[model samples]
Target chain A: MAGFFAFLGDVGRALWGAWTFDTSMAQWFGSHPDALAISATVAVLAGASTLLGNSVVLFLNRVKGWRFALSLLLNGLGFVLLYLTQAVIVIAVGQLATGRTVAWETVVEAVMLATAPLVFGFFELVPYLGPGIAKLLQAWGVAALLVIVQVVYSTSWWQAVWITGIAWGVMQLVSWALAKPLAALGAWFWRLISGKPVLLRPQDVLSGHQFMPVEFDFQLEPGEAGR
Target chain B: MIVSLLALLVVVVLLFLAVGPLEALGWWRAEGADEAVTTLAEIRAAHESVPEPVPYSHYVVYLSGIGAIDGTSIPEEEQPLIEHLRGHLPGFAVLNDVFPYAPDNRGLTAARPMARMWSWIEKARFANPEALVAMLVNARNAIQLFVCADRRYGPTYNIGTAQAILHSLFRAGYQLGSDVPVTLVGWSGGGQIALGASWYLGRAGIPLTVVSLGGMLSDDYGIDELQHLWHFRGSNDGLEKLGGVLFAGRWPGAVGSPWSRGLKEGRISVYELGPMQHNVTRHYFDTKTFAPDGRSYLEVSAEAIEAVLLGTEPKVIPVEK
Candidate 1:
């Protein structure tokens, strides 16, 4: 119990320090590998927590047999994808964009450590304030990430933002390109494996709602004009 | 040095914000209308080899919606469509037309902001012109072949799509109810283009039956020119149903037009699938279709076309999932 409180206290302090952009936290992580590991692990856990429970439950239940395995594999793949994207690929992009060299370890460590604010996601269940707080914390985490990257990459504040911003744009482009194909592929795989295709919502048509707010004075459909 | 570099970056971002940097850079512009015409001409030229001695009783063309190539790269939506047609419609020679402009989806943003941005310009329905221009580059005209149907994603591009369809039939030695009756089936935006084909190609003296599967409606002049229009809509395809209602003149009102009037006059047949969707591929093709012989919407549609062409009831009974 005491150890748990100690861990919580340490996490709280680190998160507060990150929110404040305190350089001492960065210095401490640079000197103390164990603290860095522990905190980074916590951050990873926090990140993974978003996906962990549902995936674990689905896997254990053997939903569609191979489907469960695919889901679990995808969960792990998601982590690795984020890590490679942020830690390796985005950092490389940052280097190219900013003309500054940041050690791989620095990016990896800062990324994991910068996830401090995500630990507060538990408060997301709070009514009204919960979702708002969650979003604010996420935004705060982004700011914290920019600060950490600036400090560890040893780039000017603007340069850090630029690198991360450029990386973000790249991510957007990549996601735009791959989203449909990946979705189609995944849908295909699921159908092939489970023998059930993606279902269309009955509500989609039944909504009976027009996309436009104004009722057209003109008739678009055959019988709609009379109505 | 950093200050200048930073200034340059800001300028680039502002430029991007102004003209949809990706569009300005032509990242999404895979092929132009000319390429579509060239591809069609090539395929039409290729059809001369060992042609069927007797003319094909029917010439059927399939054009799929946004983000797909109609030919070999036909996406899941129309893969089953082609398969079913092949098995069922032995009298018809199935042809796929590749329309450029709307290419495959490969960008990072899942939102498909470009499609939305361009949609505003095509429809000329803009609540936020500034935002639309920023995303669509303020250039509303120009259709991407891979994109779904719209008022004018690229109005001229539809002409290319229409040209390819028309030439393919002409080269295949087929005509309207003489050499062979033509049936054009379009899925999603392809449906809109299919209607546009009737409007455009009909003007050029080519007439064909159009089969639309959850297709967006158009307000072009030639919508009334097509002899028969079969529209297969899924009950759950709310987004597509919204298309008719969203457009100003296309929606319900006086002076009944093609999209509105054809249904009233029996020129357009509406087949409302029991549990269908905006996508026949996802709901029917990916999974097995309701038809025992793998006949989903298109196979059933093939029957409908046969009835129109040969004076028989299509008996297109929807198998609700």
Candidate 2:
């Protein structure tokens, strides 16, 4: 239990570092022997938080039993892959723009730490304001990532912004290119787990039972007729 | 120490906020399905002796505020107002046995894990004179109100609530697609619940009108489906004002929102009652407090509602900024 609390403390500090744009924490993580392990934990925490945050969709779709468990696992895997892709793009763009040979481990660490604000991702479950909260968290993560890039790559604010912007554009193109194949793969996996094709639209997921007004058959009991 | 305390407070608040969505989704899935269905069936069964298609031209469903524990638990102070409305409106059937907090109309003490706690709180509410216990009751129901207004959870919650209302109306001999206008009189948090359920109710073909009495409502799309909305607020009611402050769609700058459209198209009307508080000590239903015109506050409110229902326009007093 003590060890678990310690682990939580470490994660919290890493997140706080990202929030405050503290350069020393980034530098320490970049060179620490256990940097990879620490980064992996942060990524896993992020993925878990994101999965919990998005569980509403699965609940809304009424995914049940093994399908529900499998959907969560699949979502977690998707989050990891998305983080890896973003990290790799940032590294590529940072090196090209700054002419600096930054370590991939350092870039990955920065990226994972940047997503620490998403620890509050479950807040997306909040009514009326949930979507707005999600957007605010995303913007916070992006800003953290920008600051991390500047510190890690030893670049000016303009250079970091340019690199981040370019990386984002490249990430979008890659996503667009891989969208079809990724979707097919996801569908195939969903079929294997749930024995059905994936529901692609919100309405399709919501197409189950709806509450309709029932006409009451008001027949009286024998003793209650005169009352 | 204060920082830690503040952090803890935030976590508590976040946890509290999370419960509303979770409870709503639970209801949508399987939490109260059997109970809701059984309750509806029982309501119909109870009304078995009433003549089929009982002759009432219009129906008024009164949704009570956050302080309610069950359909029958209309606060003693507010009972006279319900009685007044019924007495004044000749051809209208007024029903108040619908609890706005739960989609299934289940009371807080109704067969749940936390039923004992809520039951205790309710007992304490009457036993103790302190307002704290009552606030707890309000807090719990207020979360449900937020769930009803929430985009992600609102549809499911509203659908369930609409089902409850529809069944209640059915038991009242409301014919489906009968074009008999159903007026929803929602007090406080019940106002938002009324608006949220209006969409599904409208789709079911009941001509709908909503009267929000000091209701803290949202800028819901249900405004588009309403025949008209008459929102009443007391001059001293800051809680009701919070609706306009909190909902971006209610702002004048949000021209594209349904509420803005409703305002522009004249489907919604806002009226001010003089110096009425939201609810509690000196609220809308407080009969002991007399206005300058030698009438009780309850009478004034009931008269305004009566005017709206009778299609006789009441004096329009602009709300003070």
Candidate 3:
């Protein structure tokens, strides 16, 4: 009952805010009523789609013998935690010198850029080198990133925003770099742990396709190191 | 091991073929009929003007359903039934003559990418400007355009369907009267056509009522935004049981099932118009029942129109399976 009422209250507030938004409503309804209808319909449909999609997932969970309430509760709380984490990050950073707090975004950007090469280097390692060891190296790489950011101080809000934006852009490029190597590492780890030869290439694994190996030439002799 | 891997690869290929390209092929093969493009200005010049007003609370738009052949027009038999409905609407003007039995020009196929598909399909399907004028001979014939579709079923088509119909209607020079709301009346595949068009029309800024008889509206397209979306199906019609996920004998997803959870959170109303096979007029006209099996399109449409006029939110009525 309380949740229902709270939902109603939030809906009422949102509706009130939308209605009272003086600038666009009059112009939109008067000049382009069809656009207004279309926009409202799109928003409503989008929201409904989200709800329907989630419900389907929940139905699958039920088939797996999980309680529906548990799924709902976990999803609901997960969203709350995500919002809280973002809020804390923003508020804590906001307290820093306005431009200084912007460093967090910078840090994220840098981490994204460096991630790919580091993962690739980790994948190049022999089977004995576990991902845990690689992860430690990644942590070190991120720490080194902070020092790099501190050296090039952001002077203004616009500069910080630009830096953040650039870092984000770099992050995307880094993700592409890391993707193949990470798959290699995963394949190696799976083979080592499962006691089987990893035959599939990283690309095949990602594309959800089967990998077929061709014949390999081998020259075998005892004590080959001497030869 | 080799055979197993080969089999696995084959199955994967088959899955892609069945779920992906084949669906696209259906849309491609079901290309919009090469109908001439008709506009409102043309319909207006030819339309028979109405001198007096009658007491109709809403106007119904009927789109022609799909034809397996490309250049087929609305069958001659279906014409009289359409004419009868218009004739009965008291002061209602029949808009069908303005939109004669023309081919759909919308370029629709299943496999096309989503963003560009709808716009292209609508453009391809809308009637030519010449056709519009010949159809709208007078105001008595100008109540609203009616149309339908064949072969295609499901909620996703709702967007393209809506785009084409609304595009045609507006292009026909018919402005929805502020005093009289628009309603959609469709049969069989026409049901899906009406539902799809109404969905987009509502989105594209038309406030209207949609009542589909034996239409294929899967739960995937959220019908909650409709002023009223009544699905009238017969117990024997075998359409109501369809959930829109089956393609070449496979489920697209759990959510595609109409009975799937959370699929019915909006104003979509479902009623079993039993013992009737896709006939809305014959079933409901004389007796107010949609068919002898006892379904009522008029009653459902009326309730929906009442809600719209009163600006009241419809109460969700859960159908007992």
Task: Report fnat for all candidates as fractions from 0 to 1.
Answer: 0.00, 0.30, 0.00
Error of 2 at A9 (Å): 3.3
Candidate 3 residue spans exceeding 4 A from truth: A1-227, B1-57, B65-72, B93-159, B176-179, B220-222, B244-266, B278-321
lDDT of 2 by residue, B147-209 (tens): 887766776688678777888898788765356789999999989999988876765556899
Q: Give each model's whole-structure lDDT.
A: 0.53, 0.77, 0.37
DockQ of each candidate relative to the true complex = 0.01, 0.26, 0.01
Best by TM-score: 2
Interface RMSD of each: 21.1, 9.0, 29.7
Task: Give the TM-score of each candidate.
Answer: 0.40, 0.87, 0.34
Runs with alpha carbons beyond 4 Å of true place in candidate 1: A1-227, B1-54, B100-155, B175-179, B254-256, B280-282, B289-311, B316-321
- How far off is residue B168 in model 1, in Å? 2.3
Tens digits of per-residue lDDT for model 1, B25-107: 13212343334446444433433333345367777777766534224443434576677676666677877744422232222
Question: Could you give the TM-score of chain B for each candidate, in order?
Answer: 0.61, 0.90, 0.47
Model 1 chain B weakest 10-residue run by lDDT: B138-147
Q: Write down the TM-score for model 3.
A: 0.34
Q: Residues A103-210, candidate 1, lDDT per residue (tens digit)?
A: 777677777776676655544322112335557766776788788888877778898888667665676687678777876776686678767654322122122221
Worst 10 residues of 3 chain B by lDDT: B138-147
Query: Residue A27 of model 3: what lDDT?
Result: 36
